[model samples]
Target: MKANPKAKADPKADAAAAPAGSKKKLMIAALAAVLLLGGGGGAAWFFMQGGDAAAEDTPKASKKKKKASNVKPHYVPVEAFTVNLQPENGEQYLQVQFTLQVDGPEQATLIKDNMAIVRNRVLLLLSGKKASEISTVEGKQQLAAEIQAIVQEPFAKGGDEQDVTDVLFTSFIIQ
Candidate 1:
């Protein structure tokens, strides 16, 4: 059983017999490197596609915005109306000022031309409301909407209809 002292230690054999912790650390480092490279490649691919897609969509979006910007709003003022409201406990009254929002100047002109009929309809609607009915915010909003709908209707037979976008109550008072 004599030991051979001249035998050289093989490096490959030493590495194969490395401790479990050392092997685990090496494997972890290699896995981390692979994952980092894979993640970077995936991110690069995604950004390249996203950039190209955004570039392609930009012109169409800009054209739509330009078209939307061409449409303008027109506002027409209406004279104040003081109507005797429906009596609740006593005589009630409502004084309201109106401004009509139209799609364009032409629509505003049409509304102004038919202002008498519009005023008559609005006065009738207002006179029918009780003081309590027009006191709340919701009631006022509903009244505005109703007025808008009525004002938008055609005033005469074979007449072009006016587009009343909204009825704004500049002043609303209930007594």
Candidate 2:
């Protein structure tokens, strides 16, 4: 009869021990998961904030300031021009309108003040062009260069260059 009682007690002890072991394993796994998640989140925050000292060493923020150049260009618009082109197969005319990009506002003002001479220089240059030469893309680019050269020339002998940097065509027609 005592042996039977001991046997019953042993079975109950086994049942309780099984549940306690399982509870210990569950707690350990939950703690591991929480710690891993917290560590990963902290790592992400550290990297996203540019890793502290890495930011100043690399000067990544300063690159943007360098890219923001301080030089500001100015522009001057010219009236449209119409001229009879040099004969090619048949008589043709050209009409073009463009703006001049200058280095500064002073250059723009100088061109505006000498508008008569500027117009003459451009008109004479256009009147000498042939219809075919001014019709194609390359020809148009060449024409812009020539116009820049002519406009950039000194307004008078021994004077400073007019500072015309670019010719931006707004309208063009060769017919």
Candidate 3:
């Protein structure tokens, strides 16, 4: 068999086919990268703007919360009381002084206006306590709670009630 020496190698055809396949692959990779970046950017923008929109929607509520937080608490002082405690092995007495914590001036005024009734109630409650009942920290705390409850109760003849948030004992002595 004799080879055809006049026929040339088709280098152009091989080059053209390889370059087309490579170009298609390169284009697909580029498209995927662009789509990934675009989707990530969109998600980031949505999350960042979502928080801002919610914050902008409730500005009044935020202001109300700030004002409520800024409001100061009012404290009303009660005169010291010396009451005879229940005898435990001997005659005992308790001398206590406390300040009442109220929400605002109005509540303080309410408690101040009924000082006599409040004092009487507190005295009655304190006089009933035994010396051993108020000797320890826990016992004193329990006594303070009972006193607060008694003082916060509604006054006689259906008077307006007072809200006592806390009872702070300035002085507590059991003798």
How close to the true structure is residue 50 of candidate 2, measured as C-alpha lDDT?
Answer: 52
* Residues 55-171 of candidate 3: C-alpha lDDT, one tens digit per residue: 646756575444444557799999999999998878988888999997678889988988998998888888888988899999989988998888878886687556677899999
Poorly placed runs, candidate 2 (over 4 Å):
1-70
RMSD of each: 10.0, 10.1, 11.3
TM-score, cand. 1 vs. native: 0.61
Q: Which runs of model 1 end up more than 4 angstroms from their true locations?
A: 1-70
TM-score against native, each model: 0.61, 0.61, 0.59
Candidate 3 clashes between residue pairs 3 or more apart in a chain or in different chains: none
lDDT score, candidate 2: 0.86
Q: Which is the better candidate, 1 or 2, if ranked by lDDT?
A: 2
Write the residue-wise lDDT of candidate 2 on 1-175 in tens digits: 3466544466788999999999999999999999999999999998886566555567565743333233366889999999999997888989899999987778889999998999999999999989888899999999999999999999989998876768999999888
Candidate 1 versus truth, CA RMSD in Å, comes to 10.0
Alpha carbon lDDT at 75, candidate 2: 85
Query: What is candidate 1's lDDT per residue for 1-175, written digit by digit as tens?
Result: 7767898788888878787669899999999999999999998998876545565456666753443345587999999999998888888778899899887777888888888999999988888888887799999888989898888778888876677777888998877
* Candidate whose lDDT is highest: 2
lDDT of each: 0.83, 0.86, 0.84
